[model samples]
Target: MDFFARSLAIAGLSVSLAACAGAPAQSRPAAVAQTAAAPPPMAPPGPCALRPSCDTPFPAPSKREFRHNRSGLLASALGPRHRGRDLFLLPGTPQWVLGKFAYGPADKDLKDEDIDVYLLRGCGAAWEKVGTYRTTEDEGSHPAVVGVADEGGQIFVNLAQVLPGGPLGVGRHRIKMVVAGDGTSVDLFLEVLPAGARIVVTDIDGTLTEKEEALVGDVLTGNHSQTHPGAVDVMRSLSGRGFFMFYLTARPHWLEPRTREWLRLRGFPPGIVHTSVTATGRMGGAAASFKSGELSLLKTATGLLPELAFGNMPSDVDAYWSSGIPRTFYYKLADDARGGVKHDDYRTLLPSLGELPAVCP
Candidate 1:
């Protein structure tokens, strides 16, 4: 079987992709190809370019948010119908917005679909409609991406290549990846971490939840997701002390929205959030591989590493240890078999945690 087919089988997407609690997403296809505007410079690959040092020409301000110009697609011409937010990163992270395209009831790849990316910076009264370009570079046929999307329906774009300026300014910047044919688009948020930021990494799911994360969906008892009694307070204390939060999860990418909502509903501090991109990335031992690799990528491009790490599973142990996180903590594991300092409650450790020197300047 091909890579995507194999991934689907491993993920069991054919039976469960629809059951996932969000907009219907086509099963991820194989890695899409990418290209930039000019000659490839000394830049990290699409997924790892975190140095915010390039740009495409900025588009003008727009009074209106993006919307599909027309909808009814499947006809003599099968066309793209949906878009999805792709990757997130620190500023200067040049990567394509993640997207997929399909047509018809079977959801076949809408090949040769040209995708355009537009940056929307909230202007005083209007959004500065940054230039809509093909690659993160400039407007042109992304020969490789178009070729891949033609075969696979991933309407992806590489990040800020030889755009035209310095990195995107830090803060919340909105980006839209649109089907050039129709206005069908995926709205995404791009955030740049504070320069020279110190990071604290924490796992979600079993680590933070007072009970199984599934309980957050308990419509019967109305039991919203609950964190450990002191979880929020402790995290807030750390945030107050100047460390940035980095939420890592092995959950499938489809759950990212629910994950974000849970974080906000529970009053967690704002920070970078990363969800596993594949089912294999999260299950069993791959969780550690995924998390460790992701942290390594962040450090490679951004030069920032976690000063403290928290996890609740053996996978987390492997992840933290392999990533070289100096200070680590895990929930219920006994003995030193799992590694890291054991902790029973966040409150009990508050004093010592607070005593640690502040991370932010």
Candidate 2:
């Protein structure tokens, strides 16, 4: 099946919102006498009402070094000039490296130059180990080297094969370099990109909010609700960073008003909200199969290629993972590694979110 058809098949969009929310007895539409059907139930004002804490201070930028030899061979590798020239070993050089990692044969000869790299995480006065690498003499073939580099200079600290499972996640990673050798050192910052452009697809339910159970209950039973801790802040951060924030939910599209309001109220930056639509032309739940179909429609409409996806339920996680999003951020009330990677709660994971670079590649 085509990608769109696959997404719709998985989404099951035909589910009626009324059925999902358990329509109120008095409010139910009359089969025979009603002149006009009551307008779809108005969603509570401000679906997203919580705002992020603007007062929360951002961490200071961190500094590191990117030193390379005149021949360009890294010291970690067996070479005469492995240490490379200390590009910014002097007092006035820029204090960060901001570029992609460079690699070469174990014995290939190269130039010694200085470059600037940007640091993604590990900011503040303290120095955090964002990345590390060792050199081996395998010049016959291209040895995967991961580190920071720029127009002036480059530094290779780790082997590329150690990534995804190492400090840098699977796709791309940002790092800081500290030139350490002899009597002088310089700080360099760098951002590493994957082989291809990638995007992250995340969920709004349990993954970003503590009120997962409550939100699900309200969706399934038409109960009033409140925002959860850290939900607004996380969404804001993700939005500010330019991620395509998609508020994908099983809730019906008719809830758009309430959903938009809730986001504004809670300070979630305005984002594209996707929800279910009813088969009879209303909103909300139908059959699980129908809901899956609607999901497929939305996916086709957006044409978003998700590299990573975050969700709470096993089904959602499995669905996204199976669809080709490799990395998964699985959130749970309890910490357990059953179906995927789990977090204690969103807050515990907040620090890591900060680790992500503020700028997108």
Candidate 3:
């Protein structure tokens, strides 16, 4: 399907704004919506005398490094069941960036960099300074090296923790990141999804996309990324119904942008997309370790277990089962030795949604 048509089919031109307390109006799909007043101005970040403070140290990165920079902002979709009178938990969210510097014929060790973070209230609203943070330089994956090596390395800049702050006004918030060495920047949105009793986790490769013989160069090159006919639609339908959808993939971090772009081009609903920093290739046991580790981290951060999980490979079966989600609700797109009821494809299984209860009993 063409990009525009797929978008229309999955997310019709009309938007339905479901009420989510403190969630920004823009975060919802669309419908008649009310806007909440902006929160009172918070104090800006402290000024730094040095050109590169903890937040923005690397102010003049080379062009080669800038082109390959990557930044990510994420917030836990799950929040506390009850807010106590004494403790206020800032939503568990993080702002981070990954990039290289001073490109040359051969990669060299990188010095630590700095980044600045600002929180956006809304469109045209003044952005408030959150804080300045520093990156930890490390060697990233390279063709010449099996493990982390100094050559052709990348650096990681993370906020470390969500710094203490005043209560934020109810609404979606945007995080803006600026590279200190160069004037490069990226922005990401954070919103606390409405409370839902059930969460759904799905695998990307063989389950949503066409069952591939292998998922190496084909995926990285955008050559083998056709989605199943109804997979995108079903995921959208679930998201609209308030299910907290999370896309769990073992695709290496470098492939993240491409994977997300592919999903958007195919009209899949937006959700939290998790990936690994390294690859053991498709269906490797290390992938099971990565997936399960991610699931464990998700549970620890969000305090919610996914009620439903989906996958197509044996690694997926082991990962989901080990994460404490039931094998019954764990639907498989194809058969494996692990043994779960398998669906021929999403088209046949989507109808079963009507039979399932909305809230976990």
Best by TM-score: 1
Taking the tens digit of each residue's C-alpha lDDT, what string does model 3 give over 1-361?
1121123222221221122333442233221111222222322211211011112222332322222233211111111110000000124443333333221111122235455666554222455666655544544432321112333333333332453554343333445555554434443444343344356788887677775432343432224356777777566556545555677777644344445445555656555556554422234577788778777766664577777787767777888878878642333434453545576557776676634544421
Compared with the true structure, model 2 gives a TM-score of 0.38
Question: Could you give the C-alpha RMSD of every candidate to the true structure, in order shown?
Answer: 11.1, 22.8, 15.9
lDDT of each: 0.54, 0.36, 0.45
Q: How many backbone clashes does candidate 1 have?
A: 15
| Span of ten consecutive residues with least summed lDDT in model 1 | 28-37
Better of 1 and 3 by lDDT: 1
Candidate 2 vs candidate 3: the TM-score winner is 3
Q: How accurate is candidate 3 locally (lDDT)?
A: 0.45
Candidate 3, residue 33: Cα displacement in angstroms equals: 32
Ranking by TM-score: 1, 3, 2
* lDDT (Cα, tens digit) per residue for candidate 1, span 49-157: 1222223343432333223322223312332334344333566566455555544324444454456666654212233334443322222334443112222555454
Candidates ranked by lDDT: 1, 3, 2
TM-scores for all candidates?
A: 0.63, 0.38, 0.58
Question: Per-residue lDDT for 1-361 in model 2, tens only?
Answer: 1122223322332223342354432232210011221222222222232112122222443433434453223422321211221111111222222222222211233223332222333222323344433222233222222111222223454323323433432222223332232111222222222233234555554555445544434333433355556555555555455443555555433333344334445555544444433211112222223334433443453343554466665445445544655556776624333345576555665666655654442
